[model samples]
Target chain A: MKKIASIIALAVVFGATSASAQTLKTVKDRGILNCGSNGSLAGFGLPDAQGKWAGLDVDFCRAMAAAVFGDDKKVKYVPLSAKDRFTALQSGEVDVLARNTTWTSSRDTQLGLNFAGVNYYDGQGFMVRTALKVKSALELGDASVCVQQGTTTELNLADYFRANKMKLKTVTFATSNEAIKAYDTGRCDAFTTDASGLYAERLRLANAADHIVLPEIISKEPLGPAVRHGDDQWFDVAKWTLNAMINAEELGITSANVAEMAKSDNPDIKRLLGSEGSYGEQLGLSKDWALNIIKLVGNYGESFERNVGAGSPLKIERGLNNLWTKGGLQYAPPVR
Target chain B: MSIDLRAGSPPARVPFYNYPKVRSIAYQVALCAVIAFLVWGAASNAIDNLQKANIASGFGFWDNTAGFDISQSLIPYTNQSTYGRAFWVGLLNTLLVAGIGIVFATIIGFVVGIARLSKNWLVNRAASGYVETIRNIPLLLQLLFWYNAVLKALPDLRDSVKIPGGAFLNNRGLFMPEPIAQTGFGFVLIAIAAGIVGSIGYYIWAKRRQDKTGQQAPVFLVSLGLIVGVPLAVFFAAGLPLTFSYPEAGRFNIRGGIEVVPEFAALLFGLSIYTAAFIAEVVRAGIRAVSHGQTEAAYSLGLRPQPTLRLIVVPQAMRVIIPPLTSQYLNLTKNSTLAVAIGYPDLVQIFTGTVLNQTGQAVEVVAITMAVYLTISLTTSLFMNIYNSRIALVER
Candidate 1:
């Protein structure tokens, strides 16, 4: 015991790099991926009646688990609120945080976390009642808007008002539900949040049809999985897992057809599924890592449509989240 | 219990560890050492984690721009203000609500406490019912009820209800006329101040004259007239030089009036009304704890009913009341932290909630907030303790 203790002390004195690089080993020993996700947001990271988690964010974590373990089901989802999301990542409480977290500059640089990739390209938008006769948020000169406090939405709202030289009255609430309730009860002329959040929140209003989300998306909100910054190896695993999903969607691979596509002649397809090279091995995984992800969680397009896209209750379009070939921002580097 | 020691013996000595004083000191040292070790361990662990994760630590984040607008603030705050100014703004707002809530809660508490002991059955029962209902429910729900059920139920901007003082009450808030004191208003303020000084002089003289010759002076009436008449005479003589900025109903909402946002009102109303119930109970217990015989003794000494209650019964009752009253006030101030639930921009809401989220420096932000609350609580209790000593029973 004394010998091991001295060795650990020596290791600490030199550097904690070896000490910090055991995340994958720990997950493998535990046999389950610990994923932090937003527990309350619908069509993004909400649990159903039976405590079954499902969302665009939820699917990304599952995809990560599948890449490493060849089984997406080996994931235990831990729910986190927005304020605690970064803390959860920094404290090593979760292996990967796939909550609907915005990748802001301060958060990426200072919060000891690295955003993997933009799984959901969202923007802040406003939702107003149909009776307000408001067309553009720019028309809301003297309007009182309700928004969740402690969010980037507050900063964005202030910025939008200042840039346009308008007076704004923002009534903030602790939670989105309270914000919606305040907006529903006529306390505010409009409710502002991420556009995806607006759609999800609009569903919980007293009468969803009475409200309309304004077309103005004021600020960009790129949300994705995040890992602690020190472990670039784990960071790569998380980042490339997202890249593989998007690449699989672009290459016409679904969960069902991924196994058959392993025999394809195309070099890119062969390389992506780990049939042509040792790219997966370089990332500290077996050659068939991407193949496992595509097989278990389907491609990014399938996950999106299943959780928050056309097939889901939110019905959000793949506007900013589509592939670069489809004129969207979701471009990934080649597997080679 | 006497055991004999030889005259030649140096005192019969117990080992230093067995001495009560030594034992207590030893125990204290052990406790402190354990606490220090725990703190050092936790801090080292946090520093290690922060370094490994590459997160920044320290108070440097206070200089950064907040980039958020609060709905209401006592001091002027904008997105351009640094986090330090936001901290003061939030602390001031918290003090504002807590100060206002303390005054209102005290006034209502005393009245309801007295009413609970009233001869009228209806008043007594009603006061009891109020205390039972309000304090029984959680303060958060009452805040929500006031915010959602009462305030939000008001008509929207276009159909705002107009009040008599060039004010409007809508779902947004109560918008009232802001008094702009111009050039002549200076004289009015000076006259009022002179009147107050003059009243104090008159009070001393009246008391002295009454004691000397049993000749009563109409001091109350004269002081009231002087205070009001001076302000009024100066106001009219200066041509009533005060303009009001009435809130004008605009296309979307009212513009250009002092606004008591629904958030502040809801939190203040909730804190006062809820805490007043507990204060009422404390007050009742104090008043009841006073002997009833004192009131009869005051009557025998030729004191009237009001004077008897005020001079004799209340003074003794206060000795009991003030201690619990201090605690209630402290609780009310601490309860003001719940303003975070309703977005009141109080210290906890803005500094801890918003600033912590923005900087992600939880340890620094939370420590500062904890220190602020401690300062407020300690200062309040100190003042109360001094006041308590004045009324405390003098026993040798």
Candidate 2:
């Protein structure tokens, strides 16, 4: 009986190992990254008229594909809701999660996930209609507050109210969009969420000028890309790809200027461009790897501006997300 | 001749064949082995992957400080609180929502169920309509509707719709008068307790007198009078023990009275409405399961319709209602996990989501959450089972 049990265990181990191996090889063979993203978050991840996924998060996925196979277009974007995103990553249904996920300790540790890097700095804030004449969150003590369920915003709102010794009613919806709609329909007195989200939502509203977002930030929300925890190799690749984008922006290597910089005589530039040394080999990729990423997807700044910055309809100010050299929190490690 | 027959029988011994009992044992063993193998393989693979990534795989992370604040906690918590504390807070919130939901749902469900069978056409149709509509939609969707479409539309604080008696309603929540305890409140509470015990004793004596002498005493009237009259008499003797602390409008909020936030109200409303629909079905089926003959027999004994329902029908219906009702309560408890969806900071949102992220103890956090839920579920089942057995029909 013992011998039989051991034999069965061995067979099961072999089966699982082989299955994972098969999936890995298949992903490599396909030469396309299966990326998960938020389907309807406008500035983060959303589809265009051509049914092509586009956003800061979507670009990050494309950049990963570019780094891997030298083609930004070689990505299959799987749109996922907040609930399904982590499960999809754990099941190997997606190569990486580029959805706008907050890097919480539980999700990182318990859910077997590794957040690559902070891509967007967000904090919870409240938005109310101008007609209400409410200035600060303190002014809305007895007001009905609308919030999305299944996110950190709900907890943050409660903390804010309790800290101020203020009492407010909370109206909750499952989706952010629903909450926004409820607020629009005058069901709630105010809608609370991350400031960035408020901007995105306000832009979606029919009358944007009527809503005013409160200045108070109640919670720290660091949204980023994430991957499954078990694979260090994969984790490193995803992490550094994000770092490279940040570094590229700081170094003034825009997509239009990247090809010109690739031929530079400067040793750091050469190394970064994969023209002099073999940094790509260490990461199991070709020379000019990062250059391909820059040329195809542009730097992090470029992605941000196009998707959610001054040029975009959302027109959100890049306060904390700016480069460290420009007085922001986005400082990357030296490329050496 | 007997010796020869025995020798011939020995010569004709049959061949051994497969035994049914042995086959059954083998099958069960194989099934168990398969399950064990799968579980082992999964665990080993997870461990191997975790080791490769250098991530610690244990519950030691639960002791770490959770550098996050929960908005609405029953217990005192801060960024300095341990992950364990956060788990407790979240569990308490979940239980709070579920406990409140079950009570409200039970009241609404029974009322609506009986209303469906009422003689008034309008009342019956409305009750039936509510059951059909709510029962068809998913609970999550209904929760969203109440939180978003319904609650979000409330007016701002400055223009909060004033109800009678200084009460205010807005998006913030409901504000009403709170009773402020004065110096003699303790004495009043003691008197109320004394009144309850005295009433119970009086009721027993009244029942015994009626049983012995065939004179039906007004037990209920006397008990009610004792309970209320005693408390009132004590209250006046203690020089009026409580004062009304009505909420007054402040610069930003209402002052004085306790504030019930909109989140709690919306969650309670959503949970009760959703669960009540299921409970209504359970109640209707229970009422239908009771035989008409029982009602007829009560009527034949010259009992009124109300008495027949109270004494004969409801007692029988309760036996059928109890087991399913227990399940509905369990469902309400589990469904309260959806509080996370609307940001109620129930166990899943605060502990499992925020605290787990801050501490990086996924295994510990999830395990603790699962255990808390399991304990709640098991305890509820144990109590409900006891209640069910008490009400169940005893056969001769």
Candidate with top lDDT is 1
Which 10-residue span in candidate 2 chain B carries the lowest summed lDDT?
Answer: B356-365
Model 1 pairs in collision: none
Native-referenced TM-scores of chain A, all candidate models: 0.91, 0.90
What lDDT tens digits, residue by residue, belong to model 1 across residues B275-346? 999999999999999898888888898999997888888888999999999999999999998886776778
Candidate 2 local lDDT, B256-348, one digit each (tens): 676676667778899999889888888888898998998898899999999899988898999999888988999999888777666677887
- For candidate 2, the iRMS in Å is 9.5
User: On residues A1-336, what C-alpha lDDT tens digit does candidate 2 reach at each position?
Assistant: 112222332332232433233433455687788999988888989999899888999999988888888999999999875544554565456889988788888777666678999999988898988887888878887666777654667667766777887666565554677678767766567888888888888888999999999988888899999987666667777887898899899888999999888877877778778887788877766776788899999999999999999868888888999999889999877566
For candidate 1, report its TM-score: 0.93
lDDT of 1 by residue, A233-256 (tens): 888999899999999999999998
* Residue A99 in model 1: lDDT: 84
